[model samples]
Target: MDEKVLLGHGSGGTMMRRIIDEVFFDAYGGEELAAGNDAADLPLPAEGERLAYSTDSFVVTPHFFPGGDIGHLAVCGTVNDVATSGAAPKYLSCGFILEEGFPMEDLKRICQSMADVAKEAGVRIVTGDTKVVNRGHGDGVYINTSGVGFIPAGRVLGGQYCKPGDKVLVSGTLGDHGITIMSCREELSFRADLKSDAAPLNHLIAEVLEAAPHTRCFRDPTRGGLASTLNELAEQSGVDMVVDEMNVPVKDAVRGACEMLGYDVFQVANEGKMVCVVPAEESELALEAMRANEYGTDAAIIGEVLPCPDDRSPRVSIRTGFGSMRILDMLVGEQLPRIC
Candidate 1:
């Protein structure tokens, strides 16, 4: 029989220690978890007055998807969230909810991924907990991550900071993560050459901020994808926004898949990509910064914020290659559930 998780593993006794030592600690160890304390003792940023803290949970179905698994998504999701605020992520806490009989080997794989990704992003998995539920009561594994970083003084970024003349940019191709998840589902099994764009983007965002200090904001288009992200920003700033459909960078394979699946490419979720808004003059600077990073080679300026004409409510519009215009709106209902 395959070695599998058992409820006893979470009993906080010898079995729990075995799981923590043989699985989690063996995969990733640091000062925090090694201390064996109830909570991690952390230090404050040396200089920055503002701190960025974010938390998120991952429960994507088919946890093992192309290009990324739940472990990668869990770490990247929280790290990216902190980085979007122009902070360099420093620490992370991960919690796992695992099902009984879940393969121990698979758990090891996920834990190792979390370690490797956290290392690359320069963030430490400082603390964590593991719990196993009875069979059929929980998914194979669900990860929750919380991250923290320090934002330098005088740095302010948010959807509300958007201004007309600010240029909108994306780190790379869109729809890769969403399409990959959809294609790999057993029921559909839609074949495509797509992989989840899940990645840690702290370094990439750092580079962008370095090149363009006047950046208005950064947002990861995860759940609602590009359309919803832009619309949210437009509404926040009370500014209309416009984009040329052709300017958005999307992989041909993803586009083809979306066409076949009757999905709007703009509304698909992404894991590793970020949408940046910068002042017009700093647009090229930001784009160049993104291109310099491995994760942002395909970065492009996709659109610009516009003054709301006649003081109308903020809205986002896209100009098609065919010369027609359409309002870009947030997804009303679920469009691909359980997609990270």
Candidate 2:
């Protein structure tokens, strides 16, 4: 534990447990995790509900960033994904792929961050696996997380559930995560501040579900951003989506960076925000609930779903402020490779 570690630390025996107990549980120990069971066996609320699950891997470069790191990213990313399904995220499983020469101090810091994030989200890392690859073959670290949550009996949400006249809402400003990482990596200096929008969204989702059960679907625009996520939902639901470029929120600093780097904000990634589709009647309620939360203070309605242009194929279109419209599609290639 002095410095960097070797492959043996990931053998799933004493070394691994030592790492877990000494660095992880030792810092975040509480009654919920003291038992050291293979998996957590906690009871759920008495309400009849079905479960929602999601998993994701984080390989963000520079490990740490202005607002988050791979450890927090691993927990918050999966929690947001599960929450987007309109369910209450409850438990998590974390798997680590570490490099042989990775620093033990960094590992401990990461685990501590993970533990804190799990506590904040009210989700426990009940089970996990770890492995080590040769220094040259692997990146510094990679984390894969699986999450499970229970969707209450009357809750309904999905990409395919969208119908014409359904309104689209965004939780907050866009492209913060992508811009922050790029700035940190390229060492670019800017007059305005830019930080990653990385945080757990389950609490906001809970409020939305409570206020707007008519919401048809929820999507976190991660790797592909808002444009790609909308295209995905359009295709899945066989509907067309129309978004107003003026209505979508983007911070001035993030917008400046995107313009300078020739990066399309619509295709940039986000960690803390989400896109919600809801019946027109519930759009106001959803917006109010999202705006009341810290993560979504700038929430706004950006678009609506309509009948697909071609029978069953869904398409996404954007309306620019200049009085013209254009089709928006999935991103062709990576805007910023190695970006989480």
Candidate 3:
């Protein structure tokens, strides 16, 4: 109680139980969550509606940073993950791993942030778990979140839904989240301000679905940036992608950071944004829907799905601003490690 927590907290014994009961349970009070099970038995929604579920973990260093913190990141990450599946996010369960010596006030702040984000996203934090680790055994805090949502009937979205001539669109500027976290962790200074674009994107996805229900796929370019996400789409759909470098929106601050660090913005990570693939004919309509939303005011059409040049494997290609073309491969290993 004097210190934050020790390794015994994660031992799944008395210490862990105490942390869960005393801290987590006390913060998120409810009966559905009191069972303390790995998977919650959720009630079904009204007939004809389908359910969407998603899970994600956050390990961003410097738990507190510009634009957002681990609490917001954990909530939005899972909410967007479920939203990308073409669902209206409804509920979330959070798990926390705390390092010894961490401040209790910090833990309370993080929980409050989570609650605020959940309320804003129109979702609820139904249940959660907590554990602690030795001082040197863990970072300050790590959060894992899982979310559930309801998808309307007759609506289908998946990687396989992509086809030649589909359009690729991103909600707003790229690499903001990765660059912001990098600057804070490295203590880098710059003329222009940079902040993480961590946010809940369920609203944008929901709007796009309403305007154009035929979207092929929706994915947030996190961990592995835009290029990596396109690569995933190509591999999944067996179709190549042609992107225009000039069409992709990247903030000046982010570009500057990438240039100085020898990092590719397309290969960096993002938290609050999303990429949507829609049929070519409905691309304009989808753009309108996204642009109307605050999170996607700068939304742009960056590329199109096409028949792979190689008959065997699909890949992503970008027409550079210089008018040359280049293959956009997946980010090797970890592009920005420890970046949510």
Candidate 4:
């Protein structure tokens, strides 16, 4: 570890893992915290009870972007984290850090966005806090959200639950949110419409769980996109993953933008997407249920879990469109900074 922190520490890759293990976990970890799932599954005061809890901070630049703004991102980010643990997100608490001289109108717009998304997701913003910093000390605004949700009985989902023969599925297209932010940040002009796929995914996930009760795990591919998210799950489950590149969906506009900008769509960020793992036998049923939901119309089975090869660590590989296979590793550094 270095004497001070670097932006790479927040990139959700190797550095982030080191910092968590050496700093946060070293100082505050317990049995439950050490598990390091997206959300903490805590036992309620009453017997035979558990709840999912998660917190996240958003610092996306430009604040407002195509399809959604920071406010919408903040709510969906936390809600999806809790929901990924197979919980029904119910309540959230928001905290705001505002730079001095920030516009009141913009703040009102953000608050309204939060309210609207909360209502749509069936979650409530029950409490919050606000702080102000000097004009140059902070961005125009940064938002932190914490959420709690109830885990339904018989719903035990975690990355470690995956095993060989399980199938991998992704919700909708990739790189929409990241490409939208990149286009806005760089002021890139394109004829095709590009928008962030930012929306609450709790409802879509609920439908999938109902149809595929034997689902092994759920993960929202946020910071490091689908590649990193799948790699993490593969390592956690001690299994290898073989993904079909042709089956993975990427919007034409987004793909073009990524090519023009030298960005890998698989390594970009997404606000309203999830990677689901379920038994191979239930893959088709899970796909059907996901497609029935508005947010998951593009859901597809992209891969399958495989037993780890002898003398090698668990990893992820993609079968390219050209009949070649390549290893897909986690993002080494920040691809698009301030992306949620």
TM-score of each: 0.97, 0.95, 0.92, 0.86
Tens digits of per-residue lDDT for model 1, 1-340: 2399999888899999899989999988887888999899999966746899999999998889879899999999999999999888999998999999999999999999999999999999888888888988988899999999989888899989999899999999999999899988844545546789999999999899999999999999999999999999998999999988999999988899899889999999999999999999999999999999999999999999999977578889999999899999899899999997
Reference-based TM-score, model 2: 0.95
Instruction: Tell me the whole-model lDDT of each prediction, alpha carbons only.
Output: 0.91, 0.88, 0.87, 0.85
Please state the error at residue 225 of candidate 2 in Å.
0.4
lDDT of 4 by residue, 271-318 (tens): 999899999999999999999999999999999999998799999999
Candidate with maximal TM-score? 1
Q: Say which prediction, candidate 1 or candidate 3, comes out ahead on lDDT.
A: 1
Worst 10 residues of 4 by lDDT: 23-32
Model 1 misplaced regions, further than 4 Å: 186-192
Sort the candidates on lDDT, descending order.
1, 2, 3, 4
